[model samples]
Target: MLTNFRRPRTERMRGGGAYVEQRTNSWAALVGFLLGRGYSAPAIAEALADGTSDATVRKMAQRWGLPAWGRKADGFIVIPMKLRDRATIASRAAQEGLGQEEYCRQFLVAGARERGTFRSVVKEGLDL
Candidate 1:
């Protein structure tokens, strides 16, 4: 038996922009490629040739369980920490035989996992 599948409709954003195609495996792959290469959501949307907003790209990445998108240097947020906190992080990192930065990353990842879904954090502009 043969069946026909209807193609997904592509629509432009309200203000007129790139065509937003239905999310599919190929689209997911494209997202992964862009994210893996450290491309920002805006850049990804631009590359998609769709005039969609960066929010769309962010949503898609979360839906696809894509890794942290965008360049590490560009994505990380720097905050001043108390000396006690810094010492604690350094000590813990030393115990794990990892760099302070790597240890802090793992620590944050664990905390984020416990807090809630990643979409909220991503939407809040907290890129990892």
Candidate 2:
């Protein structure tokens, strides 16, 4: 007599197919929350305390369309002014053969120094 041979079906195989599910990342959500609240990359890493580096935090920020921390000299300030005032600054900068940003920096530094509010270890001819 010939015996019938067949493989046993496991519970998963009996179900027809495996169920696919998306994995959730709580860490990412926490990082997004911190970034949304204006927390810097270094701050986020420190807060997480899971050996996450500031660079990683910055990468996440970049992916989330948030501004990441750039080079040290990239610390910039935004000053809101009227269109007429902006045009005047641009004209003055053009006359002086300087960009608007350079002109603004020079003007601000000069004003700060005159007001005795500018203090730095490296002074005179150094970029502020």
Local distance difference test scores for all models = 0.66, 0.67
Pairs that collide in candidate 1 are 17-51, 18-50, 18-51
The residue-by-residue lDDT of candidate 1 on 1-128, one tens digit each, is 10122223343344355555455566566667657666688766766664668898888778878776355455653556889879988998999999998897886777687666555445765543
What TM value does model 1 have? 0.36
**Cα-based RMSD of the predictions, in order?**
15.4, 19.3
- Residue 34 error for model 1, in Å? 0.7
Model 1, global lDDT: 0.66
What's model 1's lDDT at 70?
50
What residue runs in model 1 are displaced by over 4 Å at the alpha carbon?
1-21, 69-128
Candidate 2 lDDT for residue 57 = 81
Clashes of each: 3, 0
Give the runs in model 2 whose Cα sits over 4 Å from its true position: 1-57, 61-70, 116-128
**Alpha carbon RMSD to native, model 1:** 15.4
